[model samples]
Target: MKKDKPKYRQIIDAAVIVIAENGYHQAQVSKIAKQAGVADGTIYLYFKNKEDILISVFSEKMSVFVENLKVIIQESITAQEMLARMIEGHFKVLSEDHHLAVVTQLELRQSNKDLRLKINHILKEYLDLLDDILQRGIQAGEFIEDMDLRLVRQVIFGTVDEVSTTWVMKDQKYDLVEMAPRVHEILLKGIQTQ
Candidate 1:
């Protein structure tokens, strides 16, 4: 319920920019508060500490991701079509937000193993969308009938995640969204009943 508040979202969005610019260690709660245009104590109302903010940021962002994918899935699109759209949607979301790209791809990964584990828990919702596509594709006879769903999910998610990370590492020098189609082709070749 706290997440429904406007300042909560404002704080999360500001956290992205601050964390991206300052890195996780150097990004302070006060900086986030300044960015959010709220008092420093206001953050504590929604989050426990800086760690909580980091976790919440990922949660909030990925929630948007899962919601978008749900809409795409509901359009009655085939699993193969959904796969392509998912890739495009993934790339487009990060491409449009460089700060978010940096924070997610660079900053978040540098967190301690325990923190990383927590982040992975938040990622399950997004990962389920990938799994849904694989299962649906298998059901529709688009993917290999004997496909290993778990392995396929990892491959798909890793490919998309790696491409985005690499793009961020390269300072986003190239167009990321454009690579969606090519990436989709490579993934389909591996998973589709070719």
Candidate 2:
């Protein structure tokens, strides 16, 4: 029987799992196709190559993540509250999906310089969301006026990224969501108004 959803998405999802489990270097297209329960040729029909699949996965997942975060943050009345929720949402999503967490924190980073650059482009959407919050906070006097928005964005993203990576590397024994409050607190020190 034919599936209603597009075959490409299935293949990509399968690729996520395979890549997460086996690492990027070991995740052959054939393995991804098999995991998706489709033929090897089926993968090519959707993606140009293995790299295309990886890039597409990051782009698609990050796009959805940023879009959702934007809506949530818009509904928030305060920049601090919005920043808290964004961090919570990010850690929650990454923590809930082990495969995705592994793919994002570990496997995806194993790509060469070119692929890494492409992934960085995909990451801009999420980075922009953080930057928007920083800008708003600066304007509202909630955060310091002299704060470097770009550097602040990097610190926020990097801190959360490192925290999540450590959790994943530790086999995720602790609750990632519990760290959100502390993460927000530490970040606030640098940005908050005295």
Give the number of the best model, judged by lDDT.
1
In candidate 1 the C-alpha lDDT for residue 141 amounts to: 87
lDDT of 1: 0.93
Residue-pair clash count for candidate 1? 0
Please, what is the whole-model Cα lDDT of each candidate in the order they appear?
Answer: 0.93, 0.88
**Candidate 1: clashing pairs of residues:** none
Per-residue CA lDDT of model 1 for 1-194, tens digit only, reads 99889999999999999999999999999999999999999999999999999999998888878998998898856999999999999999999999999999999999989889999999998899889888999998899988888898998999999999999999999999999999999999987886
lDDT by residue for model 2 (60-141), tens? 7787679878987779998999899998999998888899999999888789999999999999888888888888888888
Runs of candidate 1 with Cα error greater than 4 angstroms are none
Q: Which stretches of candidate 2 lie over 4 Å from their true place?
A: 1-5
